[model samples]
Target chain A: MKHFSLRKLFLGCGALALFILAWKLVTDAKLVSPIFFPGPERTYAALVKGLSGGAMLSQTLETVQRMLLGWLLASFVGVFLGVLIGVSRRARAFIAPTLELLRPLPASAMIPIAIAFLGFSDNMVLVVIAFGALWPMLLATIHGFAAMEPRLYEVSALLGLSRAQVIWKLALPSAMPMILASLRLGLTISLILAVVGEMLASRQGLGQSILAASRSFRSPDLFAGIVILGAIGLVGSRLLSFAERRLLRWQAVSR
Target chain B: MVVTQLSTRPRHGEGNSTPASGEARIRIFDVTLSYGSLQIIGGISLDIAPGETICVIGPSGCGKTTLLRMLAGLARPTSGSVELDGSVLGGPNRSVAIVFQDYGKALLPWRTAAGNVSLALEARGCPGAERLAITREMLEKIGLGRHADKYPAEMSGGMQQRLQIARCLAQEPKVLLMDEPFGALDAMTRQALQDEVLGLVATTGATMVFVTHDLEEAIYLGDRIICLQPNPGRVGRIVDVRLARPRNQLLTRENPEFLRLRRELYDLIKDDHQ
Candidate 1:
């Protein structure tokens, strides 16, 4: 297993090196105009310049802040409502149809409506990001709650657990694996919507910076911005997975 | 030893020889359970004395589990009443704890063996400072002292079952209901757990209602074996197991009385299935 993972690591690095080499070859051979497609060297130079200037740092932070805020709010509401609807038949019957209908509509599509209602503001962008992230978290939570075995309920009930105790001790923990999975998915969606919202309707974020760079034909800066966005996604995913590993250590051990 | 013939009608307060041995710890009075138009448990009545270990044996769909659930107040009887110490069992009573057959599902997978046992103490509002000590004690009692840190999934089937039993015991219950808890274990593990349970109950003196389809197991563990017939399950027979206490797995199985009781239970079940 150790040797296999080492081989996998070598392969991954080789794949990345090959991709950069291909990009360098294309740019050096002028397969595409440097005006449209910047080489890896030029992109890296632009990225360094942006970092030193602090403009890219602020923009990246802005986008990340929006994503985190929206994602957190969505999680809070989604889990709360999901559990409520999951456990109560009446609540599900009353609320599920509306959520189901709303779930399929893309979060980006709501940008126009959000702009109309809230104008071009941070709140507008945040609302859109939250809206986009909500469905996955809500649906996952509901599924988690619904999938709970009846026997757990029986065990808790026989133990004379109060309603609050049952939910806290059994329901929440039992649904955690599913809940965490949804949060991972939601985090990605939140980031996507955060950038999309900035590109469409906001002024101060990585999305706006990227859009601005592209409009001015700064291909290197555009490439640099894209790379930064990818890095942000990578970091966010890694952080969440770290948290998942810590929180679900028992799940891993059991497996 | 007295054996009661299967009675289709409710025969509340009729089987126990010692009527004055206080009130029945758990009294099922003409209880019937149904879902919609389909009856699952037909009129069934029985009484379990305090500290008695009653094993329920029957074929599939016999409502043995349902009866156990009713006794635990997890399910309400469709008609008639189930009483715990003379009060109608309205809902789950704190004094009752259940050991379900599917230990994998019954135990909280997210908790360690000790954490799972702690759940009961926590629910019962055992003081925070005392939970760890009690958890360790219970885990030790179930022979899982070394495995207290292991998750239910990390443990083998028998270990998980022991963890479940430990959790149940931590409830400090007056009544322990086991629903085919050893059904998934191997023969050796099953016998070991049987003896462990017998020993635990001997010390605890808790009223036990164990449900199983295994005739020999029922005979070995029970003070009285209640056999139920299926198709809206009802009491079919109540056999008194006169086998000696502190039963030896090898010696008890070899005892003539144990063999006779096993034979009798097997014939009774065979006739019911046919």
Candidate 2:
């Protein structure tokens, strides 16, 4: 099994190397115009320069800041609403339909309306990211609270736990795994929406950098921007999973 | 080995400093529980004395669990009252705790053994500084002190059940109600836990209502056994277990009176099934 993982990693790296070689071969053969598809060497140089000693570093930071702020806002609102809907059947019945109606509408599609309301601003980008990221956490929390074992409630009553005690001690802990899972999903959505908002709203992030470079026919700069975005996503997701593993370590104990 | 453990455990005067506070007399009067038009516990009544162990035995669909739930104040009787020490039971009384059948579901899977036990103390508003000592003390009492840091999923079935019982005991409850708590365990673990429960009851002198399907278990553990008939359950017969105190599992099983009582209970239960 250990060798299998090593072999898997080896295979993954091999595939990436193969793809890069193929792209270089296509450029060498003049299969596409250099103006359209930049050579791998030029793309790599652009990536190194932008990250090490250029404006791309600041662009990456701006994107990350917006994403994190939006995710934090989404998390607070999602958990508050989720707990409210989870603990009360009346609140769920009253609020669930509207949420369901709004849930299916794509966040990207709302960019026009968002721009109309709060045009070309950082708040607009943050709001778009927050709105896009809230659903997963909200829905996950409600499901988590609903799916709790019935017997635990009986134990709670037998212990004479008050309403507040039940919520703080039982409800929150039981719902934590799902909440964390949804929060991870929310973080990913926050990143995606942040980039989209930056591109559409003409803000100073990786998304705007890529779009402007593409329009100006700077293909190397465009590819560099995309690579940085991928690296950011990889790092963000790994961090969230690390926290998830720590929080839910017990679930893995006997199983 | 379990029998020796049972016989050698702490006696009433050994562990408890205040015996009277941990004992409660349960008065049940014509309590009938219904779900819409369906009756469950059909007008049953009984009196359980302090420190006396009463085992309830009945066939499936006999409202055995419902009766236990009503006593624990987890369910309300549709038309009657259950009282503890002459006070009418309203909601869950702070002085009562229930040990449920499915230990896995009853426990908080995330909390460690000590944390689960501490849940009861926390519910009762036990001071933060005092919780650690009481949690450790309760776990040691239930023979789970070594596994204090282990989660419920990490423990065996018997250990999980013991943890559940420990959690209940941490409440310092006056009346202990168990609803087939050992039904999921192997016979050996069941016997060991039964003896453990017997020892705790002896030490605290708490009134106990143990619900089980096993006749020998009822005879071994109870001062009296209430056998209920099926289809809207009510008492069929109440048999007195005149066995001596600190009863040996092996010796008590061999006793002619035990055999005779077991025979009588078998016949009574068989009649109800018919």
Candidate 3:
């Protein structure tokens, strides 16, 4: 296992080196305009300057905070409604059609409507992010609960578990793997929506900084922001996986 | 092998107020189960005595599982009632537990052997302090003491089934309903589990209603065997297994009475199919 991970690490570093070398080559050969596409050194310099001056740091912190807040709210609402519909036939019949109808509408489409109602406030951006991230969590949770084996319910009933106990102990725990997977998907959506929301409606996040740098012809700052966004997504997903592994150790052992 | 004479005592509650020697622990009174218009179980009546291991044997569609479900209070009879301890059972209560056939599905994959057993104890409202001790004791009883920390997925089929049995036993049920508990096991594992179950029932004195399609298995573990006819299942025959207690696998199979019972049950099932 250690050797395999070491091999993977080597390959990952090799790929990154190749990408940076290609970027440097393109810049040296003047394949693209420097104004539009800066060199890796310039982008790295911008990143270091932003971090030292605390400008990019504050913007990144804002984006991270908004993303986490919106994602948490979405998770709570989505899981609540998902479990409700998943468990009850009447709830599913009544609510599923409406949810299905609304689910397909892109979160970006809601941006104009959100701006119209809430204007250029953090609340407007949060609304967009939360709305964007809710569907994956909701749908995955519903699928998880619905696909559970009937025998588990029978066992619960025979054991004389109360309805609440059955839902809490059996249904929720059984649906956890799917729920966690959906949460990971929601995290990606949350990040994307947070950036998009900031670019469109707010003035205080990495997305805004990237947009401002582009408008002012600061190519290195724009690329640095984009790179930072990518780094955030990568790190966030890795952290979630680490938590999933820890919490679901039984699943790992069982497999 | 010692030959124990079959008891011909009359069933309890015939005319006396005192609980008789063969007092019925569970009574199915003209129970019929249907799904919409499709009848799954036709009118069937049965009386199971305390500490008796009654096996229900039949063809595939013979509602053996349906009968067991009704007894477990997981399903209700369409026409009649199931009585436990002289009272009509309305729904699943603390007095009964079930061992399902598909151990893979029945036992929680997320829980260890001890944790799965603790699920039953938790449901029964056993205090937190006592749960660990009881869980360990139950697991040890099922010969899974060394593997208490293992999840169901890590265990072999036999081990998983034993874990499931241990979980049910942790419920401290007065009546245990098993629906083909060992049906998926290999021949050797099935035989071992069968003997283990017989020993458990003998020690616990719990009334058991085991459903299976294997005739020899029914005769080997059962005190009385109920054969059901299919296509709207109903009891076709009730055989009293007069074999002695603590039965040996080889000697019991070789016994003339065991062979006769097996043949009789096989003929009954064959006639039903015809």
Candidate 4:
């Protein structure tokens, strides 16, 4: 146990150390010019400048606000639709062909269509993220429910459980692990869509900041913005994983 | 210790103490089950009194488990009907419970031992206090009070099976149908659980219809043993175990009559596979 814990600690430290080393190397080597791959110091300078100026801070706030809205909306809708499709064979049969057809099309691919129909609005971005992430969540629900033992169903029936009670008590709890896995995948996809949606068709948020910097050839700011994006993605995924652990502690203890 | 002659009289308890309108505790009338055109068990008729322990022993694919399932309301016979105290058995009746052989798949991994038992009660609409009380009582009965907080994966195979039993018993059902509940356990654990089950059954006064392939297990625990032959399963013979109440597994296995009866059952059904 001691060795295992130590190894985990070492790996975590190793990752952070690697990130600092890579940043130092690029700055020291003058790799790809400071204009393109700015040093960590220059990136920090840009972050300070962006924060001091309320304009950039508001954009940052707007970006996070939009991400939260889109993420929450997509998660709720995806899980609802997923449970519906998973439980009902008729729904599955009806939607299977259509889902197969639409699932492969990239969320980014629909940006132009979204813009055309709903015009560069928050609603359009939300729709794209929901559409993209729904597949994984839906597939997880179907698989998790299908994998449940018939014996559990028999037990439920023998107890005279109502259909709703059966679904909430037995079906949902059993499918939780897979559902959480799907949520993780959905979260990742949502982040990608948020950035892509803002980049393609938006007047606010981090994506626009990157685009503005790129257009002006202010490479330091662009690199700094990209760094922040990566940070958000990393931290967001970690938060999700932490929540999953808390929710599935029973499952972990069993193992 | 032969208590009484094997009653060859057809199971007719119409005028018994149980109210005339009330159904037989377990009534299987000419139960013939099949999968498509191939019938598995034909014309199976048996009536189990309340709290009686009946062990069905037969060769593989002799529809012993099928009969148990029929009693548990998991399956319907192709030709005849199964009734629990007069009500028709369709789907799962609230009063009947089953403990399966594959405890691995039977218990949900996400639930704790108490949670697993409590789930059945919850589904049965038992109030929170009542559910908790019954869950606690049953877990204590099975000697799993300490492990109530543990999940199935943390428990040993025997513990898991005991949890299954506790879960079934918590419902306080009138009839308990078990299909090879201990068939998967090691010999030592199986024997221990056999005694545990005998004690539990006597205390609960729940009619038990257990299916097993082991002749010794059947002869040891069963008040009456029904040996079945395969290839369109049918009841081959019935052995009345005259052993006294609260059977001792080790002592009973050593009994001359027990050995003879066990051998007789095996000999009768030995040709089933061929």
Best prediction by lDDT = 1
Model 1, residue A160: what's the lDDT?
73
TM-score ranking from best candidate downward: 1, 2, 3, 4
Q: Second chain of candidate 1: TM-score?
A: 0.93
lDDT of residue A1 for candidate 1: 79
Q: Give chain A TM for each model in order.
A: 0.94, 0.92, 0.96, 0.91
Candidate 2, residue B212: how far the Cα is off, in Å: 0.4
Worst 10 residues of 4 chain B by lDDT: B11-20
Query: For candidate 3, what is the TM-score?
Result: 0.93
Local error of candidate 1 at A70, Å? 2.3
Give each prediction's DockQ, rounded to 2 decimals: 0.77, 0.74, 0.67, 0.60
* lDDT per residue as tens, model 1, B37-82: 6677888878789999999998888888889889888888889998
Best first by DockQ, ranked: 1, 2, 3, 4
Q: Any residue pairs clashing in model 4, and if so which?
A: B23-B85, B23-B86
Off by over 4 Å in 1: A1-4, B1-20
Lowest lDDT block of 10, candidate 3 chain A = A246-255
In angstroms, how far off is B104's CA in candidate 4?
1.6
Best by DockQ: 1
Model 3, A116: alpha-carbon shift in Å?
4.0
Off by over 4 Å in 3: B1-22
Clashes of each: 0, 0, 0, 2
DockQ of 4: 0.60
